[model samples]
Target chain A: MTHATLALLTLAACAPAERGRTLVIAAYTTPREVLSEQLLPAFREDWRRRHGEEVRFETSYQGSGSQSRAVAAGLEADVVWLSLEPDVERLVGAGLVTGDWRGTPTGGLASSSVAVIGVREGNPLQLHSWADLEREGVEVLTPNVRTSGGAMWGVMAIAGAADRRGADPLRALGATLARVRVMDKGARESMLSFEKGVGDAIITYENEVVVARRAGVPLDYAVPAQTIRIENPAAVVDAYADRHGTRDLAEALVAFLGEAPQQEVMGRYGLRPVREGVDCPDLPALSEVFTVRDLGGWEAVQGRIFADGALYDQALSLSRGQR
Target chain B: MSVRWGLAGWAITAGVALWVGALVALPLAAVGAEALHRGPGPALAAVLHPDALRALALSASLATWVAAVNTVGGLAVAWALVRWDFPGRRLLAAAVDLPFAVPTLVVGVLFVALLGPNTTLGRALEAAGLRVVYAWPGMAVALCFVTLPFVVRAVEPVLAELDPAEQEAARTLGATRWQVWSRVVIPPLIPPLVAGGGQSLARALGEFGAMAVVSGNVPRETLVASVYVLGEVEAGQVGDAAAVSLVLLALAAAAQLAGRRAGRWLGAA
Candidate 1:
């Protein structure tokens, strides 16, 4: 027999007889990694308390929107704790999630604010506001909105600048965008690119910059005058759990987000509490500090301002000309 | 008893076939059906969007350049390692596999360290009026780094197996060194080169880790197709992403087929 046949048989035979378990997770950045790492032990402990069985989590964490798309395409994720509301709204539109997915918890995961441009120590160029991005010789590095969920938030911050600038921040923004040296597909790369000196500044999620600083990357964040509030939502994958006979465990896992876990785990990840009375770091609040709303959503925004090819072409032309 | 065993064998085969049909092939079949049936409404809209097209073009162009350059580089390296026994020759021979052993992501980070703006080399390049860390040149460099192994490995064995008598005969016929290499040494290398070039092209086309780290996935600039597909996938646009992926797969497959055909032609020649 061929190697393919033997491998198939081996995989099939290796299946556990008692019951199998898997958690379909959709999260972004290192916090997602932390969840898969530090919190799994605790979550499984909670699972065994209610279900009397061992469990496993099959997680996919990248940008929030990507995770939402996976679920829409029949990935059958049990919990989708993604970075933004629109991602959950995607599931809502597809009928996989309820419109009230946000209503599940007041400030559970959706309570995090959008990121600001973080620069290396000493504030080189004295970057004070979003307007600084327009300055010549100022290199801005942000994640590609096409691949990064937080990148949409970054676009919203810039579009807000356009609105604040009153007619044609695109020109100003375009000039500033010309300075963008790197456009990573993910938030972490955006940070790493900046730290690696690919750019003078980067616009990313606040949690991401914080995580970078925590990881000893030597960076500081600058909140723009305007920014978007990033809401992350969670849900259970019904089909996969039922198939794996881990329904009791799945239900317990989702239901466990009631309050204590929010203050304990999600809060530490820089996500504000959905419900009141949950303690966290004394960071600026998304509500009090920023004029927040979706940056015209994906359907509205993609073709107009942030279409992938158009942006790249313009950037490419600019870079080539300079070279 | 033989008939019974045959029936059981057929049953097992059918079972495994059905399982594969349900899981892997079924989803792909769905994508194929969707791609073929779905109009330019979403997919075409995405493709026509300058960013998607640019990514496609950039990825294609990079793959092409990588294949061409690596063909010459691979043959030279392989010929030297196999034909010549210079000092530290064994070390150099093993070094060809270094690209293979290093993760693409790590290679990207390495390049970022070596050529990023912060680095002395990168700073010097920038001062000299060039940007290599986050531009198309950056993408090309990263792709070349990842795809170096394909041509070298492919040609190495072929060169090793080559009969020395043929080259001696060519030299004996009063052919000069360059002429003997051109007429005798290169002919047999063509088939393997074509085969290796095809492999390199396929890899360079799909390569994500290195390109993602370096190119910054700038639309129309550095956004390669794989990165674009990833962007689509991330944005919860599976149909659109799948559509992009289908196009990419078709292109890669076509390139592979072209490579094989070229190999056959070279072999015949």
Candidate 2:
């Protein structure tokens, strides 16, 4: 090793005049196009105009379950954007995110998409509602709820519709899973399976169907009468942002997602806007919709439906018994 | 010996011990400790849960099928390369080791593309009512593909060492081809075949990447133990994942030890 000279020591060139910062984002698999193309770039431009310094971004995308677990297990992401509220709740429980994220930064919600069903072209089977999926000989594709937070939204939609009709939600869930011939770990994988001609119908997001259709895959989607609103949350991880000193940049990107310009990009890319006035005329309105808060909060619903020995386990056993 | 040489040997031995202790033994010990962190009772109960039991049974059956298929397939491949001077013999020999080099996840995706519902063969198979992908057949095939190299590599050395002179003498002694082959050729190959099958069984038990893609992951029906551990982890039940993993690790470890013992019994090692 060469010894440093006195001139170099006197220079003390640690901080450059145009210092750069990195904002790391760990997000769910969906919304990859919008975030990479419009939201992130727009935020970078906005930050450069204000601060006159360059800001770089690093992003990783995975299924909500794995992505949330990665943040909790020390991925050091400045921002954690995920599919559902429970995933953000996991980080809060891990003490990686602030407890009151929902009160600020746009109620901790970045974008929205309602659960919908995708079927073959022309709707030969006419699978309109969740009840249509329970028909005999109709093969349904869904992800395992145990491994996917997005999958939980699909289950809740069906169960909520079943409850609305005075039918037993548990039995309805059992019947739906019985016809589930293809179940993958993530909703995206389930969609791929559907694209590969593996299933008669796929229970997924409206945005997924819209995105796939825009990509020229010949498919049609049915927005069920009674559906669940999918609210995707984005927040700055507290400990990670503090450690990286990128909290302001991280917070700005998330807040930008809920603003008019980026929210319009989110709508164009198929994800619904979190704000009410953002115009996405092509996206259909849900006939009847419910939020997670309408049923209960994330903690209550998680325990009641998905906990061990809970309703999902009962549904599995019931479905097996039916088989 | 001089003091330098003596010191070097002692240091080398200690270094090896430390390396193995840290790299191999410590992680396994941590798994065991985590499994029993809530005590052995909960760990036992975790494995004995209904879903866990079903997953364990599925995993064991997959291992058994992989072992049987690999043993037969591996012997045929090994026999062909050793006994025949056919066209493209060297290419065939090189191809036998390809499975070991390929990542098993890619192997799973390859199987999916070749035999999934969209393909012509896959469609014909479905029309014939033989569901392959997302079913038992696909899981078995995926496991067998990943483990085939173990048995083939194991049997090749033993098969190549057999002497032509001994078989010729036996044939000259009024022994028919079948009798000569059965009596002389078969007995010596048994130990290596068993050893190879054992290795295949151990490997199949712990396989995750391929099985994850091929199996539909339905609980109590198609879900295997390793995938079940993944589900538990994704569900935020790390304790349950550790317990089930401990059980799988024990079974795989037992299979490996059995294979080593069989190899040593015939000095095949």
Where model 2 places Cα greater than 4 Å from the true spot, the runs are: A1-19, B2-13, B176-178, B262-269
lDDT of 2 by residue, A1-323 (tens): 13466556555543432378878899887777677887888888999999887888889987788889989988999998898987888899999897477865468899899989899998889999998988988888888887676688999888878878888999999998888877787777788889988878998888888878877889999998899999999988988999988888877787777888787777877888888688887787668988888778788788888888888888888888765
The digit string of per-residue lDDT tens for model 1 on B8-34 reads 999999999999999989987887766
Query: What is the DockQ of the complex in model 2?
Result: 0.71
What are the DockQ scores of the candidates, in order? 0.46, 0.71
List the global CA lDDT of all models: 0.72, 0.86
Error of 1 at B262 (Å): 5.0
Question: Number of the top candidate by lDDT?
Answer: 2
Which digits, one per residue and each the tens of the lDDT, describe model 2 over residues B195-259?
89989999999999888888888888788999899888877678888999998998988887888
Output the lDDT of residue A301, model 1.
Answer: 58
